[model samples]
Target chain A: MFAFFLSSGLFLGWSLGANDASNVFGTAVGSRMVKFRTAAIVCSVFVILGAVISGSGASHTLGKLGSVNAIAGAFMVAFAAAMSVYLMTLARYPVSTSQAIVGAIIGWNLFTGSRIDTNSLTKIVLTWVACPILSAVFAMIIYKLVALYIKFMKIHMFKLDSMTRYGLFFAGALGSYSLGANNIANVMGVFVPVSPFSSISFYGLFTLTSAQQLFLIGSLAIAVGVFTYSKRVMLTVGTGIFQLSPVAAFVCVVAHSIVLLLFASQGLERFLISHNIPPIPLVPVSSSQAIVGAVIGIGLLKGGRGIQWKTVAGITSGWIVTPIIAALISFISLFFLQNVFQQKTYRPVGYLITIDAAQRIRDGGVSEEKFKGLQGREFPTAVKFSNALSEYTELTREERDLIVLSAQMDEMEITRSGITGLDTNWITPEQIAALELLEGRVFDHQWQLDEALAEVSPYWRFREDDDKYNRDLRQKLSYIYRFFRYG
Target chain B: MSKGILRKQIGIEKQIDEFLDLISESGLIFKAGIGAYLNGKTDDFLRKIEQITDAEHRGDSLRRTLEERLYIQTLIPESRGDVLELLENLDSLLDQFKGAIWQFEIERPEIGPEFHEDFKEVVKYAVESVESIILSSRAFFKNIAAVADHMHKVSYWETESDKVSSNLQRAIFRRKDLSMSHRLQLRDFARQVDNIADVAEDVADRLAIYVIKRSL
Candidate 1:
């Protein structure tokens, strides 16, 4: 049953591969510089490697924007995104899976009444607009440099041709890797919060966590998409549209891959933050947009005579229409999946106010005096609690949600000491060593200790793969840790 | 794989060169045919004409084959139009050679003692101009920088042919030893031979333009 629910995510991954793979190797294959078979093989292998290894970074941003809590909700969100991409592709318009998935997530947020992180959402939207423009700029610069090199070097015609052929294959491989790393978030991101698999140890060599397993499955679906349906699209992009020179094609692919890598690299983002620079938001951007921008850049550099304006207009309109259609489709599908199919599209969470809850609300910097009249009242959901609290005190949505989430504690007595006292039968020796190292170091949340141990030893993590639970654990642990250390 | 495609294009380019060779070879045969007719060797003149006709036929076949290869293979799509135009213009020079030689064979113009050497000189200059143009066209596919130098020689020979044709026509009209009709026929023959150099110059001019376009 869980596997059946994952089909939608797989479908989305397949559609992503089918459409975006053309952006990577279309020109090379279309120009007859590289064989389609070789391009497809390299793309499939590298894409899977990128998805399994570095697909987590952009997914965190997607998670922040909206957390689809139920498997049914996740299915609908991915399904809506895949359908939008498919329909737009059929219409011969370049569509962005990033835009489709983001819109569908926003629709899910609206349906579930979840608190949307506007800051993260705004950053994601800004990047979507910036991604193509940046690629265009990069391509223009690169194209100019290439032209200068050709003019100055007076390279032999055959040598220039061979060099471009090799450059295209290299750029195509890099593009595939970047695509897998960045866009895998859109494919399997919704499922990240409802992953059904547990960490499975393969003879103690390495543990395949639920998130990694889900990503692996999604990568396979993408590989299937590349092999089966991307050839005709590649041909269209390569020769059917604007006939690109081999060097111009190389410039476009390289520029596109660079933009995707910049957006997807968590290491780069971390480096920037650590250096006190404004970090680049890790987001899935449309590869189609990037490549189109690159081609336009090259065309403009050559005095802009050969560009097909009508096609550009059609593509831009498709970009505008795709997200709205996806959002509408997601909203309608969730309504049916929940009401008609009787599936839990959203798990309504309840909250109860207590002495600990009041303390947490105070800790969250909210005035406890406003909650004095209803200190012991219960609310069926965080939205309900926020609404009731809003009636008494003036509070913004984020602050209200933050207060409710912090105040509404689970009844389970989870603590660092309790984590230490749990059964050690399944714990690895590395986890034991890590725990011993933290004997004197106090942790506030039990799951924080679990995460810290998991960092040291992969075996100590939770069986469930939901990023929301893991994020909640980290957030609560940080708050409690701050309270203990400061006060 | 790219090398393979390039090799195919090179093959087609080589075929074009071969076609140019056939034209130059036909020009030599046409000159020989004119020389035999001037010497009143009717049998040899007829044989040389046959040879010129055969060369023209081969040149025609080769031009057709080159056109089909270019269109079917799409070897140099960006410059195919320019290349086809160059081929057509060059091929017309061969037609001029065949047409002028056949006219000489049919008319059998009276080559007076005074104009025989001059007539042969005109034919020599015309053939030399064509040979220079062929070399220039070959240089186009080999070393573009050398094309200008070869085209310069073609221009030089064409001017010499122009001077000789004018002098020969003036001498023919000024003559009192021949009939007006015969003199008129001789002048016409001189113009036909000089037209070969004129046609070669036209083809060379087109080649220069194509080279410029390709280099850019």
Candidate 2:
């Protein structure tokens, strides 16, 4: 049963990757600061570290669900949770895998007429309400602080670029770490109870160090999410909500992380309550929703004109339906399967699995199988591995006419010596595919001389006297030489 | 075929209209006149350039009393080579007007059977060029290019001022009583002044290019 919950945690980890990875570095990638690949690689390293170190608390919470009949029942619950979150992610709504998993186990517990912890459910629900509002308030304060610093320094040109780039890189790394630390348990905790032989503490001297090992799982899952369908979500977030400036993007991510960490720490929540400060609700709130709410705060400050209402409505509507659907599916699916399917389950012709691959080499030779009863997955349906390769360059015909844009990106990497981007790095395989796909295909040879001379400054920044008004000047000049004849 | 022909006709008519309007805006021409006179060639041209130097101070005050104000510039079209040509003419016009003050050029108009006749010759070219331009233009239109060819006659006369100076200097030297320093000073007076017509030729060339480029 404990092993069942662990598998469910792994599924949730995948969904978490899809939903929250975008929140970390989406702006930077969309703004062309960093490639999605580099961000994912960084995210993979740090998120795993974060999960190994900090994932245990959330994993333990998910594993504590008491309704499973055997280790397989635990796996069933985790599977239902994973499926629920992935479906929501595919629809482009970033539902919290944390919330979905929690809701799943709760609904699963109730359907079997097992003991449901109403107290825990209430605490989790309160977090759902408080997290977004707190994140927005924090972002507003951060924005005001950044604005004040700029006004005080009267900064411009070179100083602004150098300092902001370094600071943004550091922030991206930190955000990735915090996300991994906070989000990893959404995939790993349930396995703790079922695996007596594999039972290792998630924290401390364990190989993954508590929730941090979950980081690898979460990172891969989220990478798939980012690489596969993040373009629409990124567009909706970056260009739609207040047309994010770099400072605004930074503030949104920072505030979102602060809120995620608040919920992640029981010690912190307890400390806050012991004082006059309000307690953080125990439920796992989404890093995506927290970030979006903060973005909206920024947009509102910028004014209604910049906020695209249609997109916001679409995003908000998804958050509303995702968990309810997950819960219904888990309840109906888990309940019917446990009662009806258990009796008629086919017994496998047990086969021996390679033991060395499953164990470390020792003086005593290949160690005995760490745990047996390795059952094969069987259901009314087969699990299809849905890994997709992204074609970012070929996605647009006119924008793909950005043949020049891709060339410029490669040149920027060459001259700048590495990828420049903003936000947290999480390794999601999908992001890797997106990055690899962009290689060698970007228009490299057509305008090398042009990039060197006239376009010395980054296209992202506007500093020229007329650039503020001359939005079409680039297009005009490109074709002007063709038409401007003296003969 | 019909549409193509109409489009070509429309283009040409528009070009001509633009040419006419450019040459004949009298208000602008008047500003050009003062700019020309004040900025005329010499070390003292500083006095004229400063007159319109402050962009804010230019208005009817500078325009109405131009003859009194040596500060008044006749160099309109402030950013172009046309100013250089106009200023060359103004220098000769100033000398002609000054010689009229002495009444010597009218009495004897020959070289220095008049010392001032060279100046008179250059100013004649200037006056003729301006008059020809006015006759070929109405309101803000120009047919001045065809008549503009005749101004070269005055230009040739302006060029003749050089021979007048050389002859006069030879005569000064022939006279036994004249001091060497006084004769040297006489030689210097008419040297730079004779190049006014060349300046006018330059202005005409530049203006023609400007017109052509504008499809005028």
Candidate 3:
């Protein structure tokens, strides 16, 4: 059953590999500087390495946007995203899997009546615009420096050819790695909440989290896609688009890779935050758009005569059109999967404004008069609850979202089996001991469990001053919530 | 694998340099052959002919090897065609030098004392033009920016060769004592020597275009 649900995610992974690999190695293969065989091998190996190692950072933002929360729901969301990408490709429009998946998740949110985190949505949409522009700036700078070096040093033509060949190979490898690190979220992120795999320890040497395991499988599917289907796309990108010299191709690839790394590297984010600088949001960005922007950068540097503005406008339009199509497809497909197929597409979460919840909301700065009529009333979905709140109180979207979060009724039981199944290598011994003390206790909501655990042990409490530590704490807390709720 | 590629590249670079050396050396051999013929040193003239012919053969062999390696190894793919064409043109220039010397040996025309200075002057200018073109070809490989510097000088030497060859031909036709066939034969020798510089100028013009194509 797990494999049956995971097939859709794997299909999305395969499509991502088939299309996006060309963005990295297309110019090299098309120029005949690197063989297609060599490019495929290097690309597949590095992509897997990157996905397993650094894929978690971007998925966190996707989770914030909307967690799919059920296996059948994840399947339909991935299927819708993959189908939209295929349809757009068939229609000869520039498409991005990242945008498609975001739209599909939003569709799932609408169907489940879950509140879309506006903060996460705004951050993701802003990055979609910033990504290409950043790549263009990096390309222009690197191209100018390389041109100046060639002019002053005067390298022999053959030696320069050899150097460019090596440069293309390394840049392609880096680009492939960055592509996997940043874009794997679109493939397997929807399934992360309902992943059936548990963390496995290899004799205490290392541990593979369930999310990492999912990413590994998805990346392997991507590798298969690269080997089986990417050659044609690469050839077209290499020769059909603007004719770039090998050096210019190298510059474009390096610039694209840098942009992906900036958006995906957790280590870079940590380093920036530790030094009192604002961290860049980790978001999955479109690799094709980055390539187009890099190419345009070179054209603009050469006095901007060769750019086809019509094609650029067409591609930009596809960004808006592809997402709307994916969202509609996701909404319709999820409806059929739940009703016609008789699948449990989502678990209905009920919201009730209990006295304890009302007190929490009061602490959050909402007045008692705002919820006078809603006291002790139960709503089947978050949308229903928010509508009821709007009828009685004048509240902003953020305040309404906060009330919905406080009233969410997630019944969690700390059982012996759940306690024994915890990954000891991940959850510290002290955190586990705290969980053992609370064995057999019941909590009305996720935050109730969080509060109970924090009261028992400082290890579970979040540090307000440290963002990195708090992020890891939240991840562990989320894992615990799932383990106890569905174990 | 990289070491093997580097070794192959070094071998090709050396062969190209040797090929250019053969052309430059043949130009000197042509000049010496002309001087020996004018001074009536029969034995010396024959030796120079054998030497020029040997250089031309070696240049042909080296060019063939370089061309084969370039195609087989697929090195410098973007500029391979241009480099191969340049090599063939340089080889043709070497053949022109050998052909001119062979003409002198076959025809054995009786030369007057008055024509000696003009013949020597024409040969000097022709050799100078070939030498400048050789430098430009070297720059095309090693230092592309310096190619224009040497390339412009080829036209200058070709113009000087043109001046001397036209004066020598006019001087020969103006001689009333010489037979018409003999005068025409001497004129043919003058044109043959001057043709080497003309070919050098043409090769330089092609090289200039190749440089433009390669510039980023």
Candidate 4:
């Protein structure tokens, strides 16, 4: 049972790395303000710091809501949470692992006949629901006020800008720690159901509580998530929000923190829910979505016309569909893997052959009659033609065209050689006869080469229709290819 | 002077003053552009003004002045295309100045209905630079560098303005309100304003460059 829970945690960690890491540095990475490597480092370090410092909050909620901590119970909770999260990720959705963990715990507790803490669950759910909306509002409200102040005090906008750059850098660093502290639940939620810190430790601390170990392990997992899979998510999140003003960013932080704290509370539902309070489920929500929502809300405040509907729809859809799709995919993949293991049969994958192999026929690469006839004509032999293909690849597009052009010249050389009224002073009779004989064979060899290329790639068909000089190129090639019906 | 010459001289003086007024006014507009930039306003007036530096508008303006004035001479006259070039450079400088202003607006655009003191020092110098040109026309080399001195003052203000712009950008991005785009445009706006001031200094430099070359 302990092994099951541990393995589940590792699986959850992989999924969390894939989906949740983006939450930490998605905006920075998306905008290319920080490279992937830099973002990863900052996220990992700060997450570790946050987890080490303040990671105990979620640990209490996950572990202590009932009488005794059982390893079997913890294992069950971890498996359910991991399964839920893993299912969500493969579908390219950004579901909250924290929410999934919380839900799974409740499900397990309910099944085990344990009393559910509706009030705490309500607070958690409300936070999930409110997180994105509140983040957006915070960004909007603070953005408007602070931006207004900065604009009015134009005396030192430039100076203030330098200050902002430094400040944001500071915030980014701070945010990392917050992520470690706040998001550890996504990592260590299951550990709560088992023995309270019996097997976990920190540094050389004696009898470290379960909460403390969660702080360390959760931070470590988050760091891994940040380093591994944060970029893709960050890009999705960053572009989801309209280009933000400094004020908007400030507001978003305030909103996210407040909302997160609201959910983090033990008695949030009874404390905040009014008679007409909006119904919100207990779940962990996304901060990125909250900020994005806030940005859109501001735009909507201006009017629907001001809001970019497409961007809004795209983001909302991503929010809605990500989890379900991930769930579906995970279900299917797991099913397939299970069935495949049971079947014990794997199909072998097929082989490829080359032109060189075709040329190696004992019957001869070409017929003697055709080969001799081609020799009498202008075409070069197979060996020479093969060399041209290798040489052509080395040339640029323009040089390749020049090679095609030389094919026409080879024909001209034959025609010029056979010119009955030509002056013999510039050309000799023997050379003329040789040129005449070589022309047909050379031209035919070039044709055969063209046919071969057409079989493999069909270069002309691959050309983009929008190419400006394509018409001209086609016209020039009209005569040469006319015999082969290229026109 | 005939009434026509008197009217023309008055016209030149008025136009020169108006141009200077526009420079100052545009500087404010430039500030607004900065505000807009910082505030994350994509549609900035300053950014539009910066686009004026393009060949079409300036080129057309240059053409008009050439056609109106005695600019295309067979032999280089004592008074060559100096006025024509001067006006062209002035227009270019203003365009660049306007561009700089947009940088501020773009990077941190959230101007309220209040005045921006950051522009006061920079604007004074710019105004002085314009006044120097007008004064130079009236007194031509008589009070050398007196107007140039004011232009020198413009340069100092520009440097100060640079500090202000940099400060604003840093401050704006630091605030939680700014997005990635907001910070970028804010920085751009600040740098652009400094560039405008630099162009104003370039005007002064051109004046000096022209004199040194011609006088020698």
- The digit string of per-residue lDDT tens for model 3 on B1-216 reads 566666677777788888999999998888999999999999999999999999988999899999998888788777889999999999999889989999999989998999999999999999999999999998999888889889889999999999999999999999998999999999999999999999999999999999987774
Could you tell me every candidate's TM-score relative to the true structure?
Answer: 0.70, 0.45, 0.89, 0.41
CAPRI tier for the interface of model 3: medium
Model 2 / residue A384 / CA error / Å: 39
Candidate with the greatest TM-score versus the true structure: 3
State the weakest 10-residue window (summed lDDT) of model 2 chain A.
Answer: A381-390
Candidate 4 Cα deviation (angstroms), residue B180: 60
lDDT of 4 by residue, A212-280 (tens): 665576567656666665555565554444443333434444555555555444245434444445434
Two-way TM-score contest, 1 vs 3, winner: 3
Worst 10 residues of 1 chain A by lDDT: A478-487
Off by over 4 Å in 4: A1-4, A21-24, A31-36, A57-94, A102-131, A155-158, A192-211, A245-247, A262-289, A301-308, A314-487, B1-216
What are the per-residue Cα lDDT tens digits for candidate 1 across A1-487?
7677789889998988887888998878776767788888989998998888877544443432235656678789889989988887777666677778777877787777665556646755665577778888989998788777876675544345556776887788777887788777767766665676888999999877777788889989998888887887787566655667777778888888777668765567667767877876666556788787777777677667777777777777788788788888999999999899999887654566667656766777777777776677777656677778788787765666656665553333234664454334433456556656555555432333444566765445544744334444454343223222311
Better candidate by DockQ, 2 or 3 = 3
Q: Write the per-residue lDDT of candidate 2 for residues B96-201, one digit (tens) a residue.
A: 3233222322232123334444444434444444333333221112232343454444445444544664565676567556677655654543443343334444
lDDT per residue for candidate 2 within A68-107, as digits (tens), equals 4345555666677677767766766555665666677766
Model 3 error, position B186 (Å): 2.7
Top lDDT: which candidate number? 3
Q: Model 1, residue A310: what's the lDDT?
A: 78
The DockQ-based CAPRI class assigned to model 4 is incorrect
Q: What's the C-alpha lDDT at position A186 in model 4?
A: 54
